[model samples]
Target chain A: MIHDFLIYFLLIVLIYTIIVMSFNLAVGFTGLVNLGHMVFFGIGAYASALLALSGAPWYLAVPSSALIAALSGAIIAALTVRLKGDYFQIVTLGLVFIAVTLSRNWISLTRGALGLPGVPPIFKDSLHYMIFVMAVFALSVIFFYWLTNSGTGKIFQAIRDDETASSVLGKNTYFYKILSITISTFFAGLAGSLFVHYIKFVDPTIFDLEFFVLILSMLIAGGLASIQGSIAGVFTLGIFVELIRFIDRVPLLSTVLAQHPELIGASRTMVYSVIVIYLLIFRPRGIFGRVEV
Target chain B: MPSILPQLIINGLIAGSIYALAAAGFALVYYVLKFQYFSHGAIMSIAAYSFFAFLNLMGMNYLFSGALTVIISILATLLTNFLIYNPLRKRRATSNIKLIVSVVLLIFATALLQAIFGSSTKSITLGQNKVFDFGTFTITSIQLSIIIIAIIIFLALWFILKKTRLGKAMRALADNKEVAQVVGISPEKIYTYTFIIAGMVAAVGGILLGLEQNLYPRMGIPIIVKGFVSSVVGGLGSVPGSIIGGLFIGLAENIGVLYFPTGYKDIISFVIMLLFLLLRPQGILGVKARDS
Candidate 1:
């Protein structure tokens, strides 16, 4: 039972590692500060969950999650790629809020925030599911590592450092940016699908602003742009996020908390937000972050 | 069908007035510093909470709490700018870095507020709110006061911008910082004053919103988003443009309920924001040449 729980926790950490690593590709590597990247995650979760719930095979649902998310990411990139600085952030903010609204209001599609239930597990046995999740995690890490070493990776860094210089060097910066965002969001989708299947639940809250903050906290805390950092962030912050379930078990602080138990609900996010602020101020580069913005 | 136009119009104007107040504050900061002030939204919550504490905890009257909170909010905003943002600005950090810092401050403030105040929603004005009736539509006195006070503040700001020496200095700094400095206007001083004034207006907006709706830690994000959209959609640096943009958003969102579900009202503003960005990022009053 303990092993099963550990496996479940590790699977979650790995899934988020995939998601945040993808985020790092854009924010840390490509210099595209997409404030609305959660839209892709939402798309992945909704597409795969809906597909699986409607009796589509896992083979079709999972790939479609990646494909649909990537396509949507590409579309957003195409439309808003020209928006520089504040305008870019504003538009991305608009796009994602729209996605959230859709997820919330499209009751027939998303079940209207009440959340969907009884999502089928990929494998019946806990051990086999753990191995399956681990395989996917391995694949994601390998893919990101390969991406970091490829010529395209250098181009992405160049765009981040100086877009005009790279453009002057005859590199199609816009195309590379769109490509990076698409790839990043593809992995985000995969992560989202994994998340849904593991937890066996999906809801509009999955794409809420707090969820974005949680993922962002992980990316920043673990160190941006590095695979190791992504892993560290997912593991550490994922535990912090999951601690709400065991909030009562936390020692030393439990006495003060025993007085007002209602605070247990908001304490995790509160701590995460404070940590993010401190990290930004004191260690902007993060533990494993190689680049500074 | 019943004539819902008057009711909708009243709501729109009241909401728009509050948005305009906030947007105007936002524009004041953006015009000179040139970064989207991420903590601008939280200023409202800070003021609102302070207002609440002074009223309820300290046993102060509404007027005293309101004035005291506004002053406190302004000072806090100035402190943040002087301590955090100014040092970074001196280092010649990128706008992205400034943006991130502001965002962090915003998130931190919201979280800290929740931690200190607890998660429960708190209201400033106690008991049942009094509603005023027109011939066809009903409006609350508090809501009507928001519109009236908003118009008064707007005119006051316009007067300052048009006639006052400090406002002239501010405009000079915004127009061309180097030239303004050459003319002996201290950019740092202007920044300090602008942030304070911005905070004051934000406090007013906060008070209005708390009276209209309710107060909570996370209330600032959505309010801030609306203010930002209004500012950007109207014109980034233009003050009157913010008012127009705010009204437009308020009306559009209110009327959109006829076609869209109530939950999708904010969605409509976002769509409009996208349309404005793609088609006319300059906004209604913005100069085309300045857009790039």
Candidate 2:
């Protein structure tokens, strides 16, 4: 039983690590506050789920969903890159709502809030699936580490620090920004694909604000602009998010929680919010983060 | 379709008034602080719940609960400025950083509210609210009050901004902070006043919105989005523009339901905001260009 739980936990942590690292490319390195990252995740989940349900192979569904997300990411980036920073943030944030509304209202395609379940798995058993996900996670870490350390990563940071200065240096800042977002979203979509196959379900609730906040807290706490930070953030917040469940084991809190079950979710959000607020105020760079908020 | 058009317009006007009230406060803070005050909706949520507790739990009369809630809202806003925003400003944080902090605060507020009140929806009144019928359309008493009170508030705000000393100082600061400082206007003082005024107006908005609809922890998100849309549509930092933008969105969304599902009503406002941002970031009354 303990081994099974551990496997599930590790799988979740690995999945989150990929998503947060990709998210960091756009937000931490490129300095784009793209709150619409979840939209890509949702799109990937829905696409993969639909394809898998239609009897497509896991390999085919995963890549196809990721490609679809990447295409949308590039389009979104191209449309909004010209916006000033704050406007860009708000517009991207607005896209989350638009995407959620679309997913909910377009019932014929997505199944709406009813969700699409019973997605086919890549591996037969949890153990094999964990090993497969671990391989994917390792590859993602190596790829992200290489990208962030490369010359292109340097340009992303340069654009983030000052777009005009980078543009004056003759680099196409717009193209670079779009490139960063597209790549970031590709990975986000990939994570979503993996997540759906593992959970074997996809729903509009995947785009909940609570989940977004959870991912954001991970990014902030782990620190931005560092692969190490993203890993550290994923584990730290992921563990805490799961760890809070054990609060039910504590004698006093268990009774209170039993009486009011909803408090558990509420408390988790409160704790993360407090941690994030404190970090942003006093330690804007975050625990593992090099970039200041 | 034509028969329902008048009703939709009336409904739009009612919603517009509330959005205008909320947008005015949001725009006021944004104009002065030069950041998206994302917590404005959180403050609205807080005030709405406070009004709810006062009216329902404590069994206070309407006027008394409203008055008390306004004072509480003002204190809450002032405290947020003193505790959170003021410190960030002192550290010379960038607007993006502040915006991030505000978003976190918003999430915190929602979580805290949920923890205290639970996730269930609550309404101000228990039974069916009173309504009056016109020939073409029917109007609820609460909706009528919302419009009347909004017009009154707008007139009051116009008078204050145009005629009062405080309003002039606020305008001066928003126009050029350094120039206002050079002339002897204190920004700290104006910021405090801005928060207080914003808090008071937001309290009124919260009460009316709660009375018109149901109150839930997440209600703040959608309302704030609408208010943000209104502010963007009218002009980011312009007060009168927010009011106009609010009404326009309200009308558009309601009328848009004619062709789309009712669930898509919110998308109408969001689309308008995007169109405005892309095509004309300056908005109707805004003089500043988008590049800024």
Candidate 3:
């Protein structure tokens, strides 16, 4: 029983690890707040699900999800690149609101809030799915490591550190920003596809601010701009979330919380918010992040 | 078409008033502080539930419930600033950090509200059968009061800004903080007053919202977004701009469904906001683009 739970837990941790890593490339490396990260994730899930249901092979759907999200990232970047930081965040948020509204309202395509269930998994078994995710994680980690060491990565950091200086140095900062967003969004889409296929479901609820908050918390906790930190954040927060799911089962704690039984779902989130506050106050750079500013 | 049109217009006007109210507060805070208080929505939720508690739990009359609830909201806003924002400001936290903290506070606060209130929708009973019908448009007295009170508040706000010392201090702070401080205008005191005003305004919006639709702990999220959209469209931090933006959105959404499904409302709003942002980001009032 415990072994099964651990495997399930590991799968979740791996899924979030991919998301946080992908998100870090934009937020930590490129300095775009990208508040609407979930829009890309949702698009990828729907794209992968619909394509697979229409007889596309797993390989085709997987890469196509990345393509679609990349295209979306490019378009959003084109429209919003002129704006500075917080405005960009709000624009992305608006996009998320629109995307979620569509997902819920375009009932024929998305099945609305009822969600699309019974979608087939890529590997058929949970253990096999975990292995598949592990392989993907390894390849992504390797790609990030290479990218970070390469000159392109340094340019990314330069732009993040100071866009004006980067522009003065003759770099097309907008192009680089778009490139960073494209790459990050591509992986985010991949993560979404992986998540949907593994869970065999897709829904409007997948696009809420909580998911963004969770991913942000993970990146901040694990330390931004580092693959290891991404992994650590995923493992720590993933386990924390999973553990909190069972907090209601703890006899002593449940009794103390019995008066507010409805709060069980809220307690873990409350705790997470506190932790995020502490982290931002003490280590805004994150647990593993090296950036001072 | 005519039947739906009047209803839409009426709906738009009422909703616009509420959005304008929300924007008034949002603009005041964002103008001075320059960070998205993502928790603004959660604060609305707190005010909403506080109103609910007073009206339903304590069985207070409408007037007393409304007044006490606004007071609770003001105190809550002050506490948040004192404990969270003030400390962060003291350290000169980056805009991004302050924004993140607000988001964290939003998450924690919304969850806390849920834990306390339970996640069901609550309503304020106004003893119905009093809705007045006008062939094409119908409105309840409470909603009428909402519009009336909203206009009154807007007028009061304009008066305060144009005439009061605190208001002058705030405009100065919003205009240029360092210079304002140098000229014997204490930014902290002005900001505190601005927050109080913002809180009171948000409470009115929340109370009206509770009366109009049902009240849910998370209802503030959408309300805040619309409020924010209005503020941004009007150009962030501009008082008149926020009101215009709010009314524009209210009208836009209602009028939009004539050509599209109601679900497209969010899309229409965002597209309008995007157009404003990409084109006249300084706002319709054409305030010098604060940040290029």
Candidate 4:
């Protein structure tokens, strides 16, 4: 029983690791503060699910959904390149609101919050699925690690440090910013696809603020601009958040919570909010942050 | 369908006044501080809840409840600045860090409100409202008061900004912090004054919002988003711009429901904001573009 729990826990952590790594790429590495990264994840989840449910193969749906998300990212990046940092952040945040509204309102495609269930799993067996996810996680880590160390990665950092300086060096900073976001969003979309298949459900709640807050907390805790930090952040916060479930096991508190069950969810949110506030104020750079905000 | 046009316009104006009230205060803090003070929404929530408590829970009269609510909100705002923002400023935190902290405080405030209030919707039952009809359009007393109060506040704000010593200091600081400091303007003092005024203004907006809509812990999120859209549409840091932007968005959103589903109303403002951002990033007031 413990072994099964551990495997599932690791699988969930790996999925989040991919998402946070992609988030770090855009925000920490590229310095875009892309608040709408969740839109890519949601889009990818929906795209992958609809395709797979309509009889498409796993290999085809996953990458195709990722590419679709990347294409949307490229378009958004292009349209928003002229904006400065804060403006860009707000516009992207607006995209999240738009995505949620559409997912809820466009009942035909998204089913309007009822969610699409019965997604075909790539591996029915839990152990095999864990191995497959583990392989994907390893490949993602290696790819991101290599990409961030390459010459192009150096340019990404340079652009992040100072866009004007990068442009003065005859580099098209806009194109590079778009490229960074595109690559980051592609991975985010892939993680989303994997998540939906594993959970066997896709819903508008997938675009909830809680998920964004969770991903953001992980990114901040691990510190920015490092792949290892991304992984560490995800594992640390993922375990901490998951451990909230054990609160029910407490002797006296469980009885009190049993009388008012709503407090459970509210308490979790409060913990997240308080932790984020404390971290941002007291430790802005986080545990392994390479670049200072 | 006997042209619900006038009614929509009236509804739009009423909504615009509330939004303008919220956006104006938000724009003031953003102008002086040079960062998005997102906890403005939290202030609104706090004031609304306090007003609800004073009027409903404690059985106080309207005027007394409002006065007490404003005082409490100002205290809350100052406490937030003292506890969170002041420390960050002393440490020389960047704008991004400040913005993140503000966003987190908003979430924290929301969670706190939910924990206390039990996530149930509350209304500030002000008894029965008196309705005044003028041919095609009908206005409730509360709605009329909201518009009148908004106009009064804007005028008062204009007076303070244009005719007061503190306002001059604030403008000077916003124009150039170092130069203002050299001239002995005291940016920190100006920041305090800015928060005070922002708190008072947004608190009234909150009271009005509670009277108009059903109060929920998450009510602040949508209100803040609309105010934010107003801020951007009117130009990020411009005072008058936010007012115009608020009205414009209010009108557009209300009129948009004529053709599109009501669920898509927020989308209209968002799209307009995007268009304004991409094409006229300077906004309608043509404020000098900051930072490329």
Candidate 5:
């Protein structure tokens, strides 16, 4: 039982690491603060959930969900690319609200907050299937990591550093910005589909502001631009949150803190906030953040 | 048809007035600080909850409770500036860090409010819900009060901005922080005063909002979105533009709901904001340089 729990926890962390790494692509590489990153995640989950419920196979549903999320991300970027700096932030923030509303209210398609349940696990009958899933996720992460370290990665970094300078150098900066956002959204969506299948339930709450903040905190805390840093951050934070459950089990601590079992939950978030603040104050570059663009 | 239209206009003006009051406070901080005041919503929420707590628990009258809340909010605003903004300003924090800090403070303030208020809606009955028939239309007493208060606030702010020495210093600072400091305008003093005034205005707006809609912990979220939209539509950093933009948004949201579901009201404002950012990113009245 303990082994099963640890495996589940580790798998969840691995999935989120991919999501946060994708987020770092848009935020860290493009200098675009896509506050609505969860919108794509939700899109992926919803698409996969709907497909599986309608008797679609897992292989087809996953890629289709990713494509849909990528399309959505590209559309959002295209529509609001003219906005600069803070205005762009506000626009993305607004987009998140719109996305959440659609997810919650579009009852005909999304079931409107009743949520999608009974999603099929990717490999339900065997432990070997879990290993395969982990292998696939790891391979995708490795591929992206290598891609980001290549010449294209430098182009992305240049676009982030100075869009005008890059454009002046004939880089077609807008196309690259759109490209990076779409690619990021695609992987985020892929992760979302995997998550829904694993949990076998999906809800609008999964894509709310709190989750967005969690992903952001992970990305920032882990190290902004690096794939390895994001993975480390997600695992560290995810395991830390899971470990808080043990706080209530500790005999002495429980007796001293009897009046508030929920203190563990609250303090868990508080610790995350403090970590973010401390990181921002002491090392804005983040732990393992790349020094040179 | 004409008579009912006039009444709708009147109602829209009243709602717009409240928004203008809120947006002006928001605009002041944005103008001087060069970033959106994320915690302004929290200040509004805190003031509403604090006022409700005092009125219900301490047996204070409505007006007295409001005044006390205003005072407390100002103090809290000052403290927030000291704790959050002042240290960053001293360090010459990056714009990105400032933005992130604002969001962090917003989340922290929201959590703190939830911890205290327990996620429940709180309302204060001021006994001012009576409706007055004005010819072909009717208006509530509370609505009328909101309008009168909004106008009074706007006019007062106009006078201060146009005539007061401190207000001139504020405008100077907003225009060019370095230049203003070179000419001896203290950025710290101006920032403190800006936050205090913004907090007081937001508190009053919050009280008025509580009167209109029951006060819930998450009420500030939508208001902040709408307030930001209004500020952007009117042109960021422009005081009068904020008022006009806020009124236009109130009218559009209120009247636009007649054609579509009220849930889409926020979407309408958001779409307009997107269009503005795309076509006229500087906003209708904002200066070109302010786009940065």
Candidate 6:
């Protein structure tokens, strides 16, 4: 039973690692600060949930989810790509509000706030299923790591560092930005789809403020602009949250803090906030952070 | 049909006035700080709650409570800048780091307010709900007071910005921070004054909004968005632009409910904001090349 729980915990950590790495693609590599990155994840989860419920195969649902998110990313990029710095951040923030509003109000598709539950697992009651999911996640991480180290990755870094300089050097900064955003959102969607199947429940709240903060915390903690750092960051933070939940099961701690388990969740958030703050204060460059600014 | 249009317009104007007042402090901060202050929303909410607490618990009269709230808010605003923003600025933190810090502070402050206030909506029943009837229109006393207060505040702000030495220093700081420093003006002192002014104006707006509607812990969220949209739509650093943009949003939102569901009323402003960012990123009254 302990082993089973551990596997579940590790699986969750693995899934979040994928999600965080995908987010780092845009925020860390490109310095986009796309606050609405969770929209793609939420969209992917919703799309895959609906698709799977309608008898589509899991394999088909995953890629299709990425495709949908990529399309959305492209549209968003096209609309607000020209906005620089803080304006881009606010625009993305607005996108998050709009996405959540749509997810809540669009009753016909998202089932409103009721959420899509009982999503089918990938394989029937086998530990190997978890391994398979982990394998897929690992493969994607490798692919992303390779992608970020390639010539295209250097171009993205150049664009992020100085768009004007990159443009002066004959790089199409806008096109590269769009490409980076598209790729980032695509994997984020993929992770979302996988997450829905693993948890067997998906909701609009998954796209809310808490998730946004969590993704951001992971990216910041792991060291922005480093793929390996983001994965470590997500795993570390995800497991930390899970550990807090487990600790809440302890009779002594529970009795002392009897009135508020909400405090536990809040404490976890506070921990992340403190870590980010400490990082900013002590090592503003981050744990594995590469970019200077 | 014809008569109701006038009433709608009047209502829009009243609502728009509230937004304009709220956006003033936000605009001032943006103009001076050159970055978004997410905590502005929490501060507004805190001021509203403070006013409510004073009136309900301490038995203070409405006018006295308003003054107390404004004073407390200004002090808090000044302290927040000193404790949070100034330290970060002195370290020369990146804009993204500053933004994240602001957002974290917003969330933490919001949660703190929720813990203290228990997340309930607090209403101020001042017993001043009398309505005045004109030839073809009617208005509440509260609404009339809000309009008067907004005008008074706007004029005061205008006077301060135009005539006061501190206001001139603020303008110089806003124009060019490094240059202002070269001229021997301390950015820290100017920022402190700016924050105090912002807090005072926002608290006044919050008090009026609470009186007009009801005060809730979460009330500042929507107002913050509306104010930001208004600030952006008018021009980030332009006080007059924020007023015009805020009024435009108020009118558009009130009138938009006629065509769309009430649930999507907020979306109209956000969409307009998004469109503004896309098409004319400078805002309605902003200079074309402004970095906002």
Error of 3 at B106 (Å): 2.7
Q: What is the C-alpha lDDT of each candidate?
A: 0.82, 0.87, 0.83, 0.88, 0.78, 0.80
lDDT of 2 by residue, A1-293 (tens): 99999999999999999899999999999998898998998889999999999999998999999998999999999999889736787789889989888888889998788999889889989889999989999999999989988999999999988899999999999999999999999999999999999999988899987788778878888888988998998898788878777766778888998898888887777777776776667777777777765
lDDT of 4 by residue, B259-282 (tens): 899989989999999998898887
| Tens digit per residue, CA lDDT, model 2, B30-79 | 88778888788888889899999998999998889999999988998898
Clashing residue pairs for model 6:
none
Error of 3 at B203 (Å): 1.0
RMSD of 2: 2.1
Clashing pairs in 1: none
Highest DockQ, which number? 3
Worst 10 residues of 2 chain A by lDDT: A271-280
Candidate 3: which stretches are off by over 4 Å?
A249-252
Residue pairs in steric clash, candidate 5? none
TM-score of 3: 0.96
For model 3 the local lDDT of residue A88 reads 84
> All candidates' TM-scores?
0.91, 0.95, 0.96, 0.96, 0.92, 0.92
Q: Candidate 1 chain B: worst 10 consecutive residues by lDDT?
A: B283-292
DockQ, candidate 5, comes to 0.35
Q: Considering only chain B, report the TM-score of each candidate against the true chain B.
A: 0.96, 0.96, 0.96, 0.98, 0.94, 0.94
lDDT of 5: 0.78
Off by over 4 Å in 2: A249-255, B126-130, B287-292
Q: Give the interface RMSD values of the models in order.
A: 3.2, 2.3, 2.3, 2.0, 3.2, 2.8
lDDT of 4 by residue, A24-94 (tens): 99989888889899999999999999999999999999999999999999999999966864788889988
Report the lDDT tens digits of candidate 1 across residue range B200-289. Answer: 888888888888888888888778889888988898778888888888888888877778879888888888888988898888887342
Ordered by lDDT, highest first, the candidates read 4, 2, 3, 1, 6, 5
